[model samples]
Target: MTAMNTFENKRFLARIRGGDFAHPGEEEAIDLVLSHVKPQPRETVLDAGCGLGATADAIGKKTGAVVVGVDLDAESVRHANATYRDFQFIPGDVTKLGELALPKMDVIYAFNSLYACPDLDACFASFNEVANPGARIGVFDYIAYDAGALAATGCLPPSVHSMTQMRQLPERQGWACTGIVNLDLAYAAWYARFLARMDENREMLAAVRSPEVFEAVRKRYADMLHCLEQGTLGGALHLYARA
Candidate 1:
């Protein structure tokens, strides 16, 4: 796996996400999770693979949940801790949550993060370990409708799974999938807006990022749009409960 720092610079991520996020429609996605999970005050919420702790901060503020953000990237964790003082950011791996000494959680979420995990079963097992009996697990991530086309584009991570696979993996690990929202249309719309924003600020982005980096970012968005249009790549919001 590539070091997080190599491809995920803070400034570039900020530009792409329009702030502290690293994914499209992150706030809206979090709202969806909030609706499904319905966290209460003093309940524990874990933001697995939390990049920069943006979602953790938002959830902590909105739902009054005791939010804890974890990521494998030490630098990202450091920056998250510095930027979001109200929430706790820990440098840890989602697949190894047992060693993190985290409290049992009422809700756990991953925003565009689970696709990068190489071992979905192990990751879900770890989630099961740290979750209360009735804990909710929400994941918003890319779903490859046509794996061949998605692989051809090479825009997404190697571990991107189809919707069926996603559901089955969690089910095998003691999670009962309650809902799966097909968000392909929403994702495409988000990509359209993202493309427009990128174009509007192309020069500004170019100025901050290296030529190679800027082009790579641009190509990634373009490829995602193309794949979505081709009916190959898409997104989904998955909701699950501990069985």
Candidate 2:
């Protein structure tokens, strides 16, 4: 079980979220996405960079969709597979979904994962190869706000993207941009709630990996919250449909 990643037997996340998830908004984010585009029982949804299979499982339970979970991290995939049986979890790259032998996707969903990708344009194009015509894509992730502030801080990942680029790239890759939302306020609030939850369950969270690791995670997220509040980093929900 890794300390920072959403993998393995980390029951502490469930303690905070009441289920396994790797991003902000927890249940609220899921409900919002489902309200926009949910796959039917006959359809298959691809969970791009699905961290722990929890998001995919959540979608399955809500819509009866056949969900396939994919992640670049093999350990996360293995852990997700071991914990969840109703869905298939496999280790693969989001930028190359077509290379895998999985079924074509009707809807693609990612929870705070796509922003970390090195080549989002390539990822969008590759997803097109594995997606059925008219497939919808939804992503909740970090969006860049102040480039100068982001550069000044070493905490945020370099892949943090602007909302415009996020829209333009996907649209250029055969996706029709349905909408793009700025979730900066929501992201700040989420981090606050998450930090409060972690503090409330400090001892339990610390026990999962180690006290040292837990503190490191706490500090990292605290810094993230600071960035969000400072307008250096933000969050957003992007929606697109295959054209």
Candidate 3:
């Protein structure tokens, strides 16, 4: 367990998160994304950058939609398919989704995912290729308040756009901006709770993850919490529709 592995990050978070998702706000975040997307039973939902397929599984079970998940991580894709047998998990890049040749997606959502993607135009274009006309896309991830500050922490994923940059992306990519929810305060509170929980469960966490992993996580969370409190890091949910 001390060795570096593909699922180590996931395993570390799973121990702390107490849920299937690898994001802040955990189930609450999924509820927020679902409240807006509202995928019906008959609709085909695509989790564009699903990590380990938990969110997609939750989406399927909650909405009864046909869920298909895609991620660039082969290990996660395999784990997702094996763990959640009902859904299809494909190993593919969100920025090059057209090559996967997936069915026309009725709705696409990226929960705490997408911030790692440096290019949204290509990502959106690839999404357009597989998404049906009028398909909805929801992105719930980090918004760059200070890309440099956030990147230095190494706790969360890399984000390179501000709220203004994010807002302009949809129309530039031929989609309409439907809604935006600023989650700065929510994320700050979440990180505070996260750090507290980590401290409370230090002994148990040490047993679950190796010493190296434990220290790595502890340092990252501390730095992340500092950034969040300083208003140098933020989060948001951006919704869009094909036009």
Candidate 4:
């Protein structure tokens, strides 16, 4: 990835941690991920891009599994480590998982992480490095392109893979889709909450985002709200894939 891309990932991670779009309730998406992964006491798990270590903490505490979360942002790593004592949070690049000194994991959760990875092949292969045979890989994220407004976010370029393309690409990387769940209601609820948050902190939001960028984001949100109200766009997809 380019340096600019790496920087963009960091900015995106910050937005996630700030609860602008990634609210506390986004844990519901993670809940869907954990539901498919029945962890054993001795199992090791990895939560890639684990902002604030919320999912990692839940999984680690619940299953008594050794969970290690990785993220490219030092702030996120620091935040996660400072907040969650039981789960380990490492500052590392998801694109280079082999260099992270992580153990083989029985399961890897990539909730909202794959979208930031430009090289799908390399990103998926990185998961293979830390995954044991037959390991479960669960991901909960927005299926873009189909979500008209959601796709127009400035954080994401328009050239990336659509939701269908993302789903198909995993199979090519040696993963088999075990299950899929529709997350329209959750996404709609989150979007509503996000807009309200923006309203509550409009000045702060405007200070960080330029006028043009803010307008673009607003347009994207408007398109999403319209599609959401009309029930045309696909909301979100929770995938359980096995490596």
Candidate 5:
């Protein structure tokens, strides 16, 4: 239940913002989120645990929705606010979401945020509490076996998702699943591309990130490669629900 520290999270955030190793399928994943939302020009949206706010910015610009991005990472919040001024990046904890002065939201995007929280149910509950009834909720997460066995092999990060456990929780809380999209093929391709990019542009990557961060990321890529090779890992997932 240990949360990622500031330094580690910052390094991960940096790669997400500017690294040459972003998954190729990432854009498609975002598109899927947008497709589900179909936000109107005047709707209010919440990008819970928005990370760098890439998805939030995209939604805001595309639909003219008032998107509010929130994250527990202070550095990430700062970067999102500074980098995407059009969107409001608020510093807050998703596990304790009600304290923020957010408006009634039409959509809540838990993009890749569930796995990062120590207690998934608590996190979901917080989102449920803040959301308007019938509000749309979208979640994209890295799903894996216990302790992410496949990730240890090399090509992906060590991540896990109790999807079976998660799906039931939302329903128990009154949110029904509307869709579940499997991005395994897309994730595998992205991992390959990311590893190749690292191999092809080692010097450039080193220049963009600190030596320590570069080494850390290099290890992560190596781990992902190994996992893919072993076939122990399967996929990343996206789910849509309604409160």
Candidate 6:
């Protein structure tokens, strides 16, 4: 599996987020994913690109499923192991999951993580290899609505896809997309709350992060807000089953 430290702002991000998640409304998103997947006890589940194992730990506790998280960052894996002892965190790459000696997963989910994958088709193909029959896949991620605006922000990964492409690509890779929930409004609301939280903790953040870092993070959020408001970018929750 490949390992790289792509999340350079992870520490400061954790501080601003007040947790391990990289996006807003993470808890609610987790609940939504879990409800859609409905993992069974004793089933093995995979949290691809799990950061700090927060969502993985929550999944394990809630479903009594044997949950394992994999990420490309060894430091994040080490931190996750130390912090969330109930679940296992390993250093690996999501695109190469077929090569990992892990148990077949009954449910696989990625929350705002798949965008980093350089090849979505290869990733899904590997996922199919590691999945048990009828296994479900849940992903919640940003969808590009206006290509020009999305490119202008330069925040999203180069591999980011449109909502139609996201659904189509997975289906072509042998997964049947059963549902697609548009979360654009919810995303906007989350950003609104996130900005408010940042404002509320401005002093604390300023003390921990440099002025430049603080401003950069704030600007990134502001840009995202603008994109959402302009219908340039959106969010979606997708559910799929092995075909």
Kindly give the number of clashing pairs for every candidate: 0, 0, 0, 0, 13, 0
Q: What TM-score, computed on C-alpha atoms, does each candidate reach?
A: 0.95, 0.91, 0.92, 0.75, 0.83, 0.94
Superposed on all Cα atoms, the candidates' RMSDs to the truth, in angstroms, are: 1.8, 2.3, 2.4, 4.6, 3.5, 2.8
Error of 2 at 149 (Å): 1.7
Regions more than 4 Å wrong, model 4 = 1-24, 147-155, 197-235, 238-243
2 or 4, which is superior by TM-score? 2
Quote model 2's TM-score.
0.91
Model 1 Cα RMSD, 1 decimal: 1.8
**Candidate 5 lDDT (Cα, whole model)?**
0.67
Candidate 6 per-residue C-alpha lDDT over 1-243 given as tens digits, one digit per residue, 9 for 90 to 100: 112124546666666667778756778878877878888898999999998778898889999999999998898889899999988998988988877888899999898888777678887998987899979999888888887778788766566678877888888889989998889999998887888877888888877866666676777787888888889988888899976
- The sequence of per-residue lDDT tens digits that candidate 4 reaches over residues 8-59 is 4335423633631132246555566667777779799898877667678877
Please name the candidate that would achieve the greatest lDDT relative to the true structure: 1
- What residue pairs clash in candidate 4, if any at all? none
Task: Output the lDDT of residue 87, model 1.
Answer: 92
Index of the highest-TM-score prediction: 1
Q: Tell me the lDDT of candidate 2.
A: 0.82
- lDDT, residue 19, model 2: 75
- C-alpha lDDT of residue 96 in model 2: 86
Better of 4 and 5 by lDDT: 5
Better of 4 and 6 by TM-score: 6
Instruction: Looking at model 3, report the run of 10 residues with the lowest lDDT sum.
Output: 1-10
Candidate 3, position 220, lDDT: 79
TM-score of 5: 0.83
Local error of candidate 1 at 222, Å? 0.5
Cα RMSD of predicted structure 6: 2.8
- lDDT (Cα, tens digit) per residue for candidate 3, span 26-118: 888899889988999979999988887888998999999999999888988898999999999999999888888688999999976677777
